[model samples]
Target: MMMVFCENSFLSYFPNGHIFQPSDASGVLLFIMTGKVLLNVFLLCVRRQNLHQSFMGYFCISLALLDLVLLVTMSFISHFQNFMLLGIRFTKYHTCLLAQITAFTYGILHYPVFFVAGLDYYFTFTQPLNSAAVCRRWLYTATVAFTWISALCYVLSLPGSAIGLDVNHYNSAYNCPFYISSQTYWFSLGMLMIMCLILILCWSEIVDTVQSVKVITYESETVLFFPYDPECSPRDCAKHLLARLLICFISTWVPFVLLQMLIVLLGAQIPAFIEMNVPWLYFVNSFLIAITYWMRRRHLKVTEETLEADPFVSWKFCLVPFRCQYIDKAQKSTSKIVMC
Candidate 1:
């Protein structure tokens, strides 16, 4: 009687208890719709030659698509399942498979893409000479395709079987439609750790590039390598933008990933309520990616345009938004001192 009562209490908060709350459902739908529109706008604005920018654009678009599909699947499943019927199962075998798979794919696929984005930023600064080749359309396309393919293959290969849902089994509730056995749990955690390490490495390289300055002097040749200001480095200017991106990624994923890790360590002893709602955190990434990237695009465009006008501009450094600082002196020292 106590177990049944506890289960009923938990279910009441969820949409009809088995799905999502009405407010949660509305928010998810809004996120999906807004993401689709913003991602399209982002893609249209991407320059053909910006390989890193192009890669990020395609990755976000894929995320938006995945979110849209997942939303549709959840809505469809909610409609088909009659939660009020006490004797009937709330989630069918096939329905559970579809929902879990869609959610899993959306969450797991981002690990590789994030590593790629971090690498993109790192390499774009480190290899100034190779900027043209780095931004090549073909390379961006290939990298995006490879990452998605690998993530899909890994998720499909995980060991799991569809088991009937039973409230009496706390572990069973955690596994639900498709059972995520220990092997699968560890494998997914391992993948996320690997990507996180790669991101750290990328950031390390970025810091190195920001601290070092290469001086080039030649007669009848002009070049601007980095900001003339001592206090500001390329990385410093970009840190806020990159920080927001990283924060969005961590906030959206850390909760769910941490829960998965805890489950692996503690077995079924982890709190049922924490485990049940954690996956929803993954969906938060979709909305965050959309808003963060949308906000980033305007600043990126201004930086790129400024860089284009100054061939002397160092590829390794971001253009600081201090052009206005030099505006008053432009006429007196325009030729001698180029805008940093």
Candidate 2:
């Protein structure tokens, strides 16, 4: 029974000779599945309402879903890895469909996030402060609506957008996995350009905003919106550059993407022979989301602070389990899951 279950988890293609080892073990599959499940559960708990502060909720949730897709993709890869090693004949199974879903859905899902971040920054710094965050909540909903539709169009329009092809009548794949092929590189490059443009726009806005200034005459404020140094608020902006860095990562799914580009550009010869610890990149990526979400919690404003200031809230202030974000937000805001 154990071997049968193991075979299902690691694919039953391997019989006589061992082609792969613990690298594709059932244990790893369990871990990946468990971690993704837990992360997503945590996300659902926090998705109770309009995002608490600006786009952070949307940004973080999208990222979490993307990462979950990655984990699901990993499960597919691990389950089929044995086939890659010891299958009697080279085969692609229908199970490969899941991989295609992850790549295509997650691929397009990332673009809106990039555009949203750029647009967010542009509106905040470049536009009138009074008008910032003043849009209808429906506009936010519309943005998401447009995002999914556009992503569908973009993914479907891609050359060979067919998720998988029937390799043989007995087995099939959902989509072409080697997106690095010459035919698809242009599409990938085009997306890279689009995202880069967003990044550049955000960067330019940051620079322009820093150079240009407006006079501020405020009477009394409960919480300092933007934390200020003894000298000035100008100093705080410089130090919290991580804001943009976080934004860049929010939409750009480049790390896994860049790896694929290298494999394609370098060809099978190099990839086949190269013994790389590539999974480490993804592991580190998971570690990053965990830390980023945790840190974001620390920076959230209480009832007294409304400016969205305290740019870098001390993450150490949080010893609370992340689920408590709803309770800790403030008694009036305690029902944060609905708002954020």
Candidate 3:
């Protein structure tokens, strides 16, 4: 005799003849697929040397991988019957704990990745000359390490007493094996709020800079370059590139953050329709990232490539908005000294 628990229309079915319907697992499934696609794109980027080519690309790859780790681990626990059975029954405590830690760590890392990326763009646009220090390889490596270490330390410090399996405890609920503490809940929400604030500030400055630039065509190219004022071209292009990056970041995260905050603060149950959709929203960053790269590739195809001598190869990619083909020539001119 299977006992089914119904929470609204969502049901859960247990192996022990205790069946309940919870919200559909489609959201988690969607996340899994999104992660897979993102991973493929990430691998492609690696093969194409895109990730190694720019600091921004490296950060993007790190973010994508972290996102995939979180989604795949969460999905595995949700869909693998044996794993779910063990987790729900508390049969394998250590294994379950490891999974919990892995998921939480990856989820927490999301905020720091955004925090660093936002800072990178903010400084790269607002402080052009000084931004060179910010984009240094050592610094980028340190930032990535800091993100993972901080998240690990924070998760490890949470009280283990509050961590346990709550299997179908509610009349209408999914039997999630990992029970996080209220402290964890508050910490996660706080992180999201902080990240949102940082992005808002960063993008505001970027938009302001972009608006200040008087865009004009140079040599038949709709370049942001101020040919008469060569000093301004690099900065203009920086602003334009950062503006697009900001848009991509915000579009993919704001809705997901709002929904998460609502669910956390109000105890409002997610609507079935939304529950099936929000998980995909979380992974939309990956798609936007790929689209950003594809757009760049398309732009390259449309425009003829011009080679120039620059001490830094990454600078070429960094000046993504303006074709920057003649930037070095402009920099060498007596009128201005432009250094990227």
Candidate 4:
């Protein structure tokens, strides 16, 4: 009697995991749908910015796009095609397997993208990056092609018995995702370990780069290779390096890193509690990737207080609405001025 009164269903997400009755179905669908839409809009914004030419930006966007596909497929498509009723057991195991596999692949694969993103930032800060060019675009495109092909091959290679990723049966006519066999789980887990090692190496190098810069800043008088105007706010450039960077790595990847170790290394079952907490992971990834695009597309507006210090002005400023470019000179100077 007590069990009947409280929620008996095991909800997959936590902080709101208990589902007492069947009426909550609509709410769940709505939640999933909203996440799906945000993800897509974020990706579209990323694509328009052509940060696709930059390896880190491109990879992050790719990761977001892959997650968008996997989540939507899980939310809507998998639900429909994946598990039909067999009195209580679900059917269409193949679809569920494919969806689950793709989701896992995206989850595992984004590790490389994050590593690349961190590396790009580290390189930008520590080493000379070549000017962006047409050939660079081709390289990024080629790399994207290779990653997609490899991931696709991995997904299609799953065995038939692992078709439906069913961890357990659902009550009523339900469609839970399928589960790979223990052997395959270990295999997937191993891939995640390799991903972790790569991220750690990249992060280690980034730290070294930062420490080296710190040493040079205080210990040596070497002029910065690319000088910044001392009068300008350091925050302007530093915002990209410090604040945005922390959000990209710590917020986006740290939860993922812990989960990778938990699920992959320990083979420990992640509490639905932790899994649900990271619901924002996809949203944040989309947001960060979208932010890079936003940064790229943004015009650097030099206000009155800051304009005097700009080393040079871009001619594009002439197109700004109602903005003025004026010349002021003393009467004597004006007479001496020559039009060239």
- The residue ranges of model 1 lying beyond 4 angstroms of the native Cα positions read 1-52, 73-95, 107-111, 128-135, 161-325, 328-340
Kindly indicate the candidate among 1 and 3 with the higher TM-score: 1
Clashes of each: 5, 16, 12, 6
Task: Report lDDT (Cα) of residue 131, candidate 2.
Answer: 34
Worst 10 residues of 2 by lDDT: 269-278
lDDT of 3 by residue, 1-340 (tens): 1233222221111111111223433354445447555654544443322222233445545655654555565556545533435325422222334434444454444435544544443333333333354466677677667766887787555543234444433323333232222332444466567556545655654555445443333332222342222244655544445454444344435665566677678854322212222233223333333323334432432211211111112223323345356666544444321222
**Whole-model Cα lDDT per candidate?**
0.40, 0.36, 0.41, 0.37
Question: Candidate 1, overall lDDT?
Answer: 0.40
Regions of model 4 farther than 4 Å from truth: 1-34, 43-53, 67-95, 124-132, 152-175, 178-340
Tens-digit per-residue lDDT, 219-285, candidate 4: 1211111111123354443332333233223333465546555666565542121132123333333
Error of 3 at 285 (Å): 13
Candidate 3 stretches greater than 4 Å from native: 1-22, 26-56, 70-79, 83-139, 160-162, 165-340
Task: After the best TM-score superposition of candidate 3, give how far the Cα of residue 112 lies from its true spot, in angstroms.
Answer: 4.4
Q: In candidate 1, what residue range of length 10 has the lowest lDDT sum?
A: 270-279
Which 10 successive residues of model 4 have the least lDDT summed? 1-10
lDDT of 2 by residue, 1-340 (tens): 0011121222222121111222322344346445655755564563323222334334444545555665665566556743533433223333333333333443334334544644443343223234335463445556655665676566545543343323352233222221111222333455446446545645654444334322121222111121111232544443233333333243233465575557446643211001111232222232233233334434533322222211222211122222333322333331211100
